[model samples]
Target: MTTRDTVHELLRRIGESDPEGVAELFAEQSDWRFSWPDEGHPSVPWIRPRASRADVAEHFGALGAHHAPERNRTTVTRILVDGDDAVVLGTIAQTVKINDVSYTSPFALHLTVEGGLITRYHIYEDSLTVARALSGDTGPDRRVP
Candidate 1:
């Protein structure tokens, strides 16, 4: 599949909350990083580097496990594709299961597809807002409004 096709499929699978299906579009050995300086952040299950397709699957699985699919909302504002590189800009809203506090954070997900599979998956998002919500902080500023 083309890079754009692969990315669109990935988004479709993610919308369905199908973890394994999402991983199927990735290379066996992939470069994955979710938000740099991962430390000092609430240990949200999906907030770590993933090296393999299995790890990628696990990340999405953990996401589905921790947040209800009906409650977790991700809105894709734009998807820019250039050859094998695609950058998805969006906002994500989820309520942490443990604390039940909701948060909204704008995000940028960069993906590189080669050989019909995604080789790089990198994400940038507002960690502070997520961390605050995970800790049950209900401050008005936490929602990024």
Candidate 2:
């Protein structure tokens, strides 16, 4: 399959919340990276570096553990594909089950496909918003400027 096809399949698997299916589309030793400053941030279980396809499945599994799947929503607003790379711009909203606090933020996924499998997956999102929600910080001042 082509790079674009692989990315679309990944999106489909994510929409289905099929963690195992998602892992099957990734290369053996792929890069699943996230951009978040970990200093004061709450340890989001699914926000760690992932190297293997198994870790990819675990990431999704852990994500389901922390958030309410029924309340999770992702909308792809734009997509740009070039050769082996695809950039997906979208919005993701998820509610932390423990705190019942929800965070909705814009997200960008940078993905690279090679040999019919995904080799790179990097996501950029509002870390502070997610951190605050994860920590149960629902103060009036929690709104990010």
Candidate 3:
């Protein structure tokens, strides 16, 4: 498969709750990094880290364990590929459980694929919205319920 195709498929596996497949889509020595816009909110800040394959596995595993009640719905907005590298821009909509409350965060993903596998992935989302929803404080415009 083309690099773009491979990357999107890997992400699709994550959305589908197929962590095994997601792991298989990466090269054994792949350098994977996931980042998000970090501003404030120390308690629940955006995530950004470079990880090994095992580290990535643990990362997603923790998320799955935490957000067990929420099913992810991801949609690809754009995909860019150059040689062995590719980037995917997409939205992730999901309801997460926090203190028995369900919260949704509309988010985006910036992925880098290399050697027909994912190398790096960054996240972009409405952090304020996520914080408000998680805190049960109702966002400015978007109501949390």
Residue-level lDDT tens digits of model 2 in 87-132: 9999988888998887898999999998999999989998878887
TM-scores of all predicted structures: 0.89, 0.92, 0.68
Superposed on all Cα atoms, model 2 deviates from the true structure by an RMSD in Å of 1.8
By lDDT, who's the top model here? 2
Off by over 4 Å in 1: 38-42, 139-145
Worst 10 residues of 1 by lDDT: 136-145
> Which pairs clash (backbone N, Cα, C closer than 3 Å) in model 1?
none
Q: Candidate 2: which stretches are off by over 4 Å?
A: 38-40
The numbered model that scores best in TM-score is 2
lDDT score, candidate 2: 0.85
Name every residue pair that clashes in candidate 3: none
Worst 10 residues of 3 by lDDT: 38-47
The residue pairs in collision within model 2 are none
lDDT (CA) for every model shown? 0.83, 0.85, 0.60
